[model samples]
Target: MKNLFLCSSFFDVAGILPNFLERINSNCIQTVSFIDIASHVEEYKEYVEKAKLAFEQQSLKLEVIDFNQSSDDIVQQLQKNDLIYISGGNTFYLLQMLNEKKLTNVIVDLINYGKPYIGESAGSVLLSENIEYIKKMDNPQNAPNLKNYKSLNIIDFYPVPHFENQPFKNLVEQVISEYGESLPLIAFDNKQALWVLDKTIILKDET
Candidate 1:
């Protein structure tokens, strides 16, 4: 019952998701909690707008829960949502917040219970065993004192998001040289998605 649709860019990929809707129980994703950590550096209006449009286009009712409040408050709110979507952003900061809030275990519990979860960009990177891949794409100084750098370990391969784009693309070689030897790395852009259902893994992208 493990279902995941780790996407690169929700709006950027556009019509691609409708194809995978059937796998998500056809429940219309009624309530949602969007972890908006990635867009922390910018206004959230755009991300929310795009997400709203995407849900509407799919004929799904989405009630986005605000997660910027206290960890206790967030956790309480989380119980109301049927879906959890982590948006792309500063991975280090995102993980830092999750740990600092002590909300990591709750998320682990939720996902382990077979709740559908979606991750994009930095969100996708956190699904690996470790966030060492963030060394190349994001700055750890935001959470430099972070002691536990371990990721969710839900997936085995490291998803090097933003394969051919700026900033992130520049560090691909370095990330590969450092971790690619032991850890498997799969590079993807805004147009791709990694679909996971228990033991089966599929890459949804343009061939």
Candidate 2:
């Protein structure tokens, strides 16, 4: 019952957002909480800035939440916000933090119980059926204690973001071939996204 905006990349929002987010009204969006994972890795931190800027450009206010915060604090933020935007990062590390902090269930319950959520890259991967499709992109060793690879299963199909072109496209093919037998996979470019409202699902591309 939760509506979701699963983005491929927040950096190119200026090009993809108009047509992709046509169904959503910016005014209706009250508050947004940015669930950040990029900070865990020094390189992915820029993604957080891009994400925050993307939302601000659309007049959306946000609160940033990272692993340093407690589950209770995260839950409080989730309860106060109208939307949750989980940014891209090391998927393995992100999942590790989620488990280590015991916040996985809190997030799953919130989103399933009807909290609007947004994800880019690793964030998108976390909500899928399992992180198996991204084995090539993330290091499993980063999350050694992870017992299950199962994802939130918020969406029936698996979506691989950042499949812009060439080598990335080829990687997508490999992922699809590996998991396509049991799970339907959707590929999205940096300028594309998957929008879910109510029970309907659709793909959104740059204008």
Q: TM per model?
A: 0.86, 0.87
* Pairs of residues at least 3 apart in sequence or in different chains that clash in candidate 1: 38-89
Off by over 4 Å in 2: 14-26, 42-44
Consecutive 10-residue window with the lowest summed lDDT within model 2: 18-27
lDDT to native, each model: 0.74, 0.75
Compose the digit string of candidate 2's lDDT tens values, residues 1-207. 766878778776545554444555533666888878645764547768877887888777888876677788878888888778888877777887888778777888888877777888888888877886788766777777788787677777777877756546776777767877877777888887788776788787766
- Pairs of residues clashing in candidate 2: none
Could you say which candidate leads in lDDT?
2
